[model samples]
Target: MDHKAAKRRKLTDKSLPNVILQNPDFAEDSQMYQSLLEMERKLDWTITRKRMEIQDTLSRNPSTTRTLRIFVSHTVSGQSWQAGTESDNLTHSETGENIPAWQLKIEGRLLELPQRGKDKGPPRKFSTFIKRMMVEFDRDTNVYPENNIVEWPRATGHHNPPLDGFTVRRTGDVPTHIRIVMYLDHYPEQYRLNPDLSSVLGIKEESLLGVVQALWNYIKIQGLQDKADRRLVRSDERLRAIFGVETIPFQKLPEYVKRLLSPPDPILLHYSFDPSLPVVEPERPTAWDVEIKMEDAALKNRMGVMLHTNKETSVALAKMDEEIALLAQSLHNSHLKRTFLQSFADDPAKFIQTWLESQSRDLESVLGAGASEGLTLRQEELRRSEFFRLPWVEEAVSVQEGLRLASKGM
Candidate 1:
């Protein structure tokens, strides 16, 4: 198959759990496919019906009604561009280094009711405006590609492109900005209740629901409707603090609720180089590291699924051995990080010395084994050996020992 065809197939393939992938028998299980198909059909029908109902409502009353909603999505592009690859894609022209890019999409809609004239208290004409924007970003080395944004149905299409007035802008060097956007886009628990709001209502701030959803839930729970009219909300102590009045027209509640939200604090991106400023190292692994960890996890899961499939099979047993070895190495690295790295955080010099010593010890063992067999270590062997005595190692060791002694005396 051609590269493009293969890539398309890989992209379109249904992502099965590690178990199903490891066990092809399960992948082709007719019963499983049928069940999934049936569930998908039912969900589609239910969603289609609900959407139609919403459209009907909007069409019936466009003048005074509107839906205030925002949706975010992310997509990963495997394509990369080298510097000076202007013909291929927009990229840096200097170093010719490959630049990685991904896309983020944000969509929002607003419905406005305008006052026509003195005779008309409020405009009867409704204006519904929908906008969507897609932004491309250089994915941070620590960002996971699996966090790719999936398409959702909007209007008559799935995975719709950016709408009118959409534009792309580059951000500061920090990749966390992109990471944050992706996180906010796909966060599963979106609607956690705010503490201040919860206190006013005398309820615990529960699930991670958005402010709008949380407020709606609070209103429903309180049952604080106007005595004479159900269309109005009668203010209690909490509602009074919220609405600043004893009553709020049901239609205006949304407006008031929105007012309570404080805008998020701005993130600092640009900074002038200052030699006086202390250098701060990254606190955690980058997206690239995270992607590798995820791959390792998937491999482990697949291995387990294979083992469970048919433990007697020679192929499965051999795969299990290989997976076990890989897992062991991963565990060793994790252990070292948790052990020495955390302990020497405050003393980086000591950390470096200790790490070098550890490497030296391992190398010594390898060299000793080679010598025991009457084999002379070559230049390549010496270079690769951690314990191969070097001038820099001696100097670092001396400095580390002196520092340790000085600290003890002090």
Candidate 2:
């Protein structure tokens, strides 16, 4: 009895927390209970390690794991440009598609593949690399009338896919349970503005333009360009409330905006894995594997499309070349004929022929005797005129005068 009691004490001592071993019925199966507890603890640890690995994979490949939010920027008729205006007359020449005067601001990070000998994955600094990209109005929102058909941008007919969707929670601060969760988005502060700044800017109480583009637009519309230099912006009484000074350089605008408008409470998203929920790997393939397969299929389709387009383009080009060749040949023949005809254009034979045709009737009507008399009178008149100007005629006249003087002397 003493030995058995000692064994029981040893077993109870080895059991953890003393809570399980204290039970009257548990004493019989204490070892089994201890083994089960050990297994449960080990399973929890393994699950936690798996969760960490999954999160790391997600941050590295957000496209496959995370669904990015597509921010929609609307331009209502009154708020933005009206239809049929100069600004609304934009069109893309390449696609022959009209450009939407109002556009959506789809903000996303460009995940550039790391260069050789560098970190070989997406960038970690989300805010610095976040870019506001413009997209079609119809893509992210359905605010436009159903009848209005928005054309897709150029080179997007084949490759453009819909944006992924994910659970979003907008909160004031980054919540706890950071081990399992990862932030896929970082939103700008969104809070109410100072009453003085709002009143001076002439914007509604609800409007939030405190930070960047929107505030800049207001400054531009107010014609606040400094007289001395355009780069220096001299503010009016309204803007003075925000800037705290009469003037500020355009570059320093963001600094003043930060000062004037209170930044909004942070918007946090909870992406943590639920410990209570079972860790069920989907029966469907992993996102990476699925993406790889889709990419390969897409590449093949694109190549086929390109080949077909090139063939059609080649045929069209050949037809155009044939037409051009025909036109050139006809032009060359015409030029040769024109040269041949122009060579004899100034020939003496042609001139004589033309003159004879014009004077044929008048030639037969002339009087012969009158014509001969006219010809003789014309010859005599020509000889008389030649006598005064000719050197030989002057010499002969001088010789005759000398002879007359000699006769008088004799």
Candidate 3:
């Protein structure tokens, strides 16, 4: 077949590189360069997918908030509080004798209020917002009380097994007041935006990341991005009134947004517990519902597993990349060899003449005689076909022919 027909057939062939290399046209460096570009595009797509997965995992529940009902109640021995049932006949651990004790029951549960939206399923039995609860007891006496700080670790049944209730017992006089502190895990502090900023953001209180994301959404919806430079934002009238500027840089958006935020209002609860009154009467435990942000443990754990890189996998990938690079280099060298042989195979006479001219130029440049009189004389001799029919050529041919004949006879 003609070279052009063979080249067209090779281009349309649906076969591996090894099979395609059987055709001369497929062995061009241009084909190899195109293959490399395709490989790079695939690699870029893979990396982009991985990055998107990470971003989706991180932003899954950026500001997950829940209402937790904190119940605090006080009761003496032999009396039951509304918090939960407790053993009144508790004996001292060492003495093994019945002792008068004052019990403070501190419990937390997930509250499903009608005002708040309905949950997808039954509310969780416990609060996941609280990592642990710290209860401090202060007495009127000068002596420091033992077990002053009672820690309740399992505040939520989401990840950990649920506990019935957390109780603090004191053998001596009952204190008039107690302090309860809740510690949270993976919870970002919320801020209350000023009136001007809140009007633009549409939310009075939000986490810093949430606020920034909302502002970005607003900018995108309004199409305030500068056409000439995307890094600069063209402030609309509302934004201008809020930021007090005509334009804002994308990077400085967070800084300006932060200035309009103040600390969120603290939750305060006041309850007067009387031990003498019955639990069924007006002396029941006081419960306060407080909304707080918390991380989704299940989603976070899944994301963590996805993001975690195995050392063995990384090593294997690195080895594979090295092998690919070596193979690509080998393929490139093979392509050069194939092109060289194909050129000679297509037209032997012309290939030889072209190759000789290239070699003569290289030799002249290497010998530093390209512009000398000797190079001009050599070029003049090379232009004639009879230059190879000189006396030296005849003598060399005779010597080679004698050597071959003598070897065959021997």
Predicted model with the maximum TM-score: 3
Query: If the candidates were sorted by their lDDT against the true structure, best first, what order would they fall in?
Result: 3, 1, 2
- lDDT of predicted model 1: 0.44
Better of 2 and 3 by lDDT: 3
Query: How high is the lDDT of residue 254 in model 1?
Result: 57
TM-score (C-alpha) between model 2 and the true structure = 0.27
What shift in Å separates residue 35 of candidate 3 from its native position after superposition?
Answer: 12
Clashes of each: 15, 1, 0
Residues 298-408 of candidate 1 have per-residue lDDT tens digits of 233444453243545656645654554465456445545654655564465667767755765666677666433423445466458676366766776776677778899
Model 2: per-residue Cα lDDT at residue 365: 36
The true-versus-predicted C-alpha distance at residue 368 of model 1, in Å, is 99
Best model number under lDDT: 3
Clash pairs, model 3 backbone: none
Cα lDDT tens digits, model 3, 116-170, are 4465545554534556666766555556546766766763445666555676767
Q: What are the RMSD figures for all models against the true structure?
A: 35.1, 44.5, 14.5
Higher-ranked by TM-score: 2 or 3: 3
Q: How many backbone overlaps does candidate 3 show?
A: 0
**Candidate 2 lDDT for residue 42:** 72
